[model samples]
Target: MSIKSFAAKIFAGYIRKKIDNWASRPVEVQEKVFRKLIKKGRSTKFGKDHDFLNISNHKEFAEKVPVRDYEELRFYVDKMVAGEPDILWPGKPLYYAKTSGTTSGAKYIPLTRDSMPTHIEAARNAILCYIAETGNSRFVDGKMIFLQGSPEMEEKNGVKLGRLSGIVAHYVPAYLQRNRLPSWETNCIEDWESKVDAIVEETRNENMTVISGIPSWVQMYFENLKARTGKPVGELFPNFNLFIYGGVNYEPYRAKFENLIGRKVDSIELFPASEGFFAFQDKQNEKGMLLQLNSGIFYEFIKADEFFEEKPKRLTIGEVETGVNYVLIISSTAGLWAYNIGDTVQFTSLSPYRVIVSGRIKHFISAFGEHVIAKEVEEAMQEATSSTGARITEFSVAPQITPEGDELPYHEWFIEFEKEPENMDVFRDVLDKTLQEQNSYYFDLIEGKILQKLKISTMPANGFQDYMRSIGKLGGQNKLPRLSNDRKIAEQLEKIKKQ
Candidate 1:
């Protein structure tokens, strides 16, 4: 056996044993984790300010630390950025991961010595778990092409700063580094188009076994490779069998990715963020990812429906029920306390807890009294593609304001296509029909004459990327939103088209 495959076998075996032991008592494990986090951080500035010493249990802990978003925590984070050591954690963070999509454009989330290794371990376990379940390790024997940001990080207060993926890329297990490619210099190129070309040129004939990246960027790479070689990706890398992806929902680009690869391959999904690595797809039979209970994070859930209320009820790991939409609150070793990262999720299992992402708190559309989320948009988009045999490259939706003289507001979807459908009217109809079926408020609005059928506008192939680049959010961990309550994103797209 090849050395790489031999190493994978050992890694996979160890992960299986750990998974079996951890999966047995999910609640108990989480309680222990919370305790460890509290004890370890009780003396930090944030802990002292929040009265962490007085908190002995989850209830007191919850009462002491109210839920907060980045804005609320900005005071402490700003202090850290100015090099105030031990403001949040025990010492200064090793680096910061620059994230986007806030009112403030970009946010620098700390990457601490205590927290960075957790990110690495979660990724390692995600791969090993897949191998343990599928008995497929051949992919590990060859190189993996990770489409990540440039590792040419900037420094803020003596701490390195870059995209989270680039920082993690710098610290993956030494053994796996031997099987990974496209040199660091090429990855450091700031121009995405040039970087993609460099990646395509370097790895075209290599023994590629796995591909890991955001779906859209991967699509761009595949498009470039196909144009250069006049062949599908499967022909270029016959041994490739695994695709690991995250940072965006894969549903809209599912058919396009398959068409590019020329076959179905094993896929493992992860819910990773600058804040913490929360979940991963561990079982093929399961509907959602297993929530990592012992990952140095203390989790709280507030029902999404009540998230904006005067006082929403908070649920802990033991009290959480399946099928409830909850806004996840995390307090982790990264020095964040009861921080809301904006993503909402629904639990699918409780015994061995697992969850599926529902949508972003800020990205949902509720302008017309019809609450539509990323999950609904994605499912509707899938049905539309399947019924019409069309393929979408990227899409975003916004509520079209009702005219001053009219009571009906409709949805306008801006889409870029890989393969356009023969019948545009049918494609639009199926998409509207699926949304009506998925969301009751949306269905009521359409049926009661409160809303009109959704409209679809075709965008130029590169329109979305153009807008993203304009906003300095192209590539790396950046992702497009599925739905917006306002026309902010739609208006930007229109301007890009005009340009």
Candidate 2:
């Protein structure tokens, strides 16, 4: 190993020990984090407005500070954007992560000086944890590529504004700076297609090892690389072994990715957002990511099923249980208080608090009182593909309430296939049966003649990509929702579906 790799191994071992120390006492660490956040929050305008002075514990905190989404929190956020100090966090924010909001047009999530380091540390420790566990530090000596947004930033009221990934690009550690690709100019390209082409030209022949990005965008890069060089990505970059990703589940895309790379590679899943870096896969054999209990963020969980109910009970980390889906709420050093990020997660391990992102709270179908989530659909698809030896490129699920004929209302699955299943009927049956088995309400609806078996609508090649492009969200942290309650995305898919 090179000197740098040797040093990394030693550092990784130290970091792993530190992680274990905190992870061992998850509840205690979280309590300490909660205290610190509450203490700091008392100084902010929001804190005072919510009567933070008398709040002594999680219960009081929840009672005083109602969970608010971005739109609900915009009053304070707007003040922060207008250069007001102490509106949310102390002083002005260091940066504003600009993201396209669902209801609100544009959201500027603050990145305070105190909270910024946690993001950097969590990302670094994710790799360090991998190195320590697998004893694979040599990849650190090879080139690493993060398919992400431009590093360029715009200033609004003296605060730097850009995508979260772009802001993070500025903080790439000095040690890995030498090994990171593509060139700054290539990353700065506004168009994703042009950027991917430039990236391919810049790093096609280089010794790349660690590649990280959303799976869909990386799939596009892999396809472009194959098109140019007539070789699988693995053959082109022999050293590449680790694939790190977040934003969406990778299971549905796993078969397609394996086919593109021509081999199976280990991957790390991260749960990161503009609000906070919540978790990361710590072990190769583990089912879920290790929740960051001590990351200067206080976490609360409300059972997803009861999330819509009035005055739903909120549970702290110590109160959460395994296998139960809960909507994740966070109050962080970044000044977000009792903020709902809209993500639902299920705990796989309660001892160290490991969780998998289950789905979005809003992204589910309940058109017929048969609520179905993204995780269920993705799991069903995974099982069907595994059984049929089919490879899916992309897919989305929506409730089809009104059929053209006498057919009963059913779930419509829009699928883009990398390799179509030999038996379409069998594939559809497996999907429907699997979904019914997982969701009891859906099972009742189907059995009671209220809904028919789910139907599959195959899309033409690049159909999903075309839909994303048409909506002006083709790349850079944008993700196609896996499940939708309405037909907005489904209708768009229909327009581009193969005849």
Candidate 3:
């Protein structure tokens, strides 16, 4: 056996043993870790202000610190960015993960020396756990290309500034670095198209076995590779067996990915965010992701209906029930205190505490009280694609509720297609029918003549790309909002189409 294979076997065993105790009593593990987090940050300004010293449990912690959105927490984050020590967490942050938050601009989130592990360790162990479960160590023996952001971190106020993916890429472990494709120079190319071209050239002949990135970028890479070399991706890299994806839902793009790959490959879903590395698909056969409980982040959940209220109810792991959409709140060692990250998640299993992302609190369409979310839209699209022989590259939806009073309001969709549906009218009907079945409010709106059926506009080629680039949010972890309550994004799409 190869030395690398031997090392992977040992590492997999160690990881499995390390995490076995965690699944047995998840609530206990989180409770114990929450106390540790409170104690660790008790000396910071945020800790003292929130009475962390007097708080020893979840109830006490929630009572003292109010749940805050990014706008409210931006005060402390601003101080940290201005080079203030102990403003939120103890000492200055090593770097800030630049991301698009609630505001129109970028939000700089802190990544402290102590809290970096919450990102790094969780990602590493996610892979290790997968290997332990599947006994697939051959992935470690070949090159794996992470189609991530540029690793060229810029300095702001004497601290590094980059996207979360770029920050993680910077710290790619030395062992994996030996098997990783695309040099740092190629990764640093700011123009995404140019970088993708460089990546295609670099990884074309490599012994690639594992690929990781957002599903859209990975698809683009595969498409380009096929263009450059007249062969299917599976034929080029016969050993490529794993595809890791996160950031956005992969359901709508799955068909396109499979077509490009020319076969079914194992894929893992991750729920990592700028706030923390939250959850990952640990067991290949499991339907839901295993939440990361002992990762220095204390989690709280509030039902989506209650989350927007003046006094929201916060629930711990012990209180969450399966199949209900709950807004996620976190108090992390990375200096966030009872921060609401605006993500909506649903628990699938309470015994081992497995969950999956439902939607974003702000990204849903409920202008007319339909209360439609990302999960609803994505699943509906998946069904539509399956039934209509179509493939979606990207799509977004908005409520057209203020249409001519004589006519009923309807849902408007702007779609960029990899392969257009054989019959567009049928595809739209399938989506509308599925959504009506899934949501009572939407059905009521349709039945009572309050709204008409869905309206889908097949966008010009690369419509989404042009829109993103025009707004300077073109690449590197930037994802298009899939659903919105207003016509702002739809109007923007029209402008992009005209241009």
Candidate 4:
């Protein structure tokens, strides 16, 4: 390894120690860390000046910064596309990571060399820890496959050559570069749609040991692969050993993924966003994901119940609590200060600071006049599954409001599961009861019968992938969107309905 690569590892180890120490403390100790966070918020320039951009400092400032949706970032990204310097950050960003925001409206998120190191450190450190935990240094000698997004895309200001995954590929340490799946497209492709066929073709015959990408997309890619090879996926790529996934949950497609490949492969979850990489599964127990908070960014959390309307109690690395879900806010080297990434997670145990991501707070339905958050949905789903002895592989709940004459006024679920319920009527009743007991809104809806019926659409095995594939969004960073609240989301639903 070069000096930089060697140094990165050493720095990662040091940061890991701090995280472990903080995670292991008592609840009181964790509370103390929040006090320190308030002090730091006052000192940082990025934390204080950019009112709209910075939110983590909400506790210190009486007038909290406004939450910006993706459109607000679009103008800044357009400026970056125009080759403008120091628009969003203090210095010039390297380029943008083109991503599908809320629509087909592709967004080019600004990324600078200074900002990128955080992503590198967080991701690389997670990889190193995984190797240490699993004793799987085979990555050092074996080839790895990354199911990346479009290698390129057109920016809002008309500049091309914007691809976050490709840019990351460009900056990775050289020693590891040789072990990657060979792709000249990684260097040349500038628009995402232009290279889909080539990317699919590149993996046809390789000694692939690891596969990394979003669950839905990876499933779609292999489904396509099976069509091309005219053989079971196992026969086409027998050497594949592991599946590394992030950006979305993998529970829904787990059984299908194993069955398709015809071998038991290690599965890992990575929690990353457009801002930077945040956490990864430490080990394979389905326990808690280890966070790389200090590696690349400054991290804090707000109480789950504390919306922006209320004063959010921010927690530092040391000041987190177990069982209570908190919202994540981060300040990164890229200059995002107190940025709320809209994720809700809770600590399982502190010793190592293992956390379980509950889900997105913004992605829940609050119809029937009761506020139903993502955490409640997850718990109710779990309860329903346990009671029925049925495992839900994948499920999504869309909240809908109907007119007075309409029958169902609350919500609907499009669920994909491995086995059909033995007694359909009993299964539905059990699930509805579980939700009603777990959440007040659900219970109210059932008691009043205001939401007349709950519709459950059972999908074919691996059906979620088909949904994602139809939209051309299949890779890491492309999530199975939880609650489709926007108007366009309805259109997407109609497409699925037609399909």
Which structure among the candidates has the greatest lDDT? 2
Which 10-residue span in candidate 2 carries the lowest summed lDDT?
Answer: 490-499
Q: Whose TM-score is higher: candidate 2's or candidate 4's? A: 2
Candidate 3, residues 121-158, lDDT tens digits: the string is 88888888888888788888899998888887889889
Worst 10 contiguous positions by lDDT, candidate 3? 98-107
User: How does model 4 score by TM-score?
Assistant: 0.76
Best by TM-score: 2
Q: Which lDDT values do the candidates have, in the order given? A: 0.87, 0.93, 0.87, 0.63
**Residue-level lDDT for 381 in candidate 2:** 97
- lDDT of prediction 1: 0.87
Error of 1 at 429 (Å): 2.0
RMSD of each: 1.6, 0.9, 1.6, 5.6
Candidate 4 on 1-499: residue-level lDDT in tens? Answer: 4454455456556655755675455344434433344444344343445443343333543355434445644555565557765555655556667666665476666566666786776666666666555655554555677767545444444334555676677666787778676475643653333444566677777767777887766776666777778866667767677788876656546656766687678777877776777778866775778766444466677886776655556777667778877888765555454567778888886666677777786776665555566556556566556556676556677766763564566566677776666776677776667667767766777778777546666666656656666777544456776654433454455466566
Q: Residue 378's C-alpha lDDT in candidate 4?
A: 57
Q: lDDT tens string, model 1, 413-460? A: 999998999999999999999999889999999999888999888999
Off by over 4 Å in 2: none
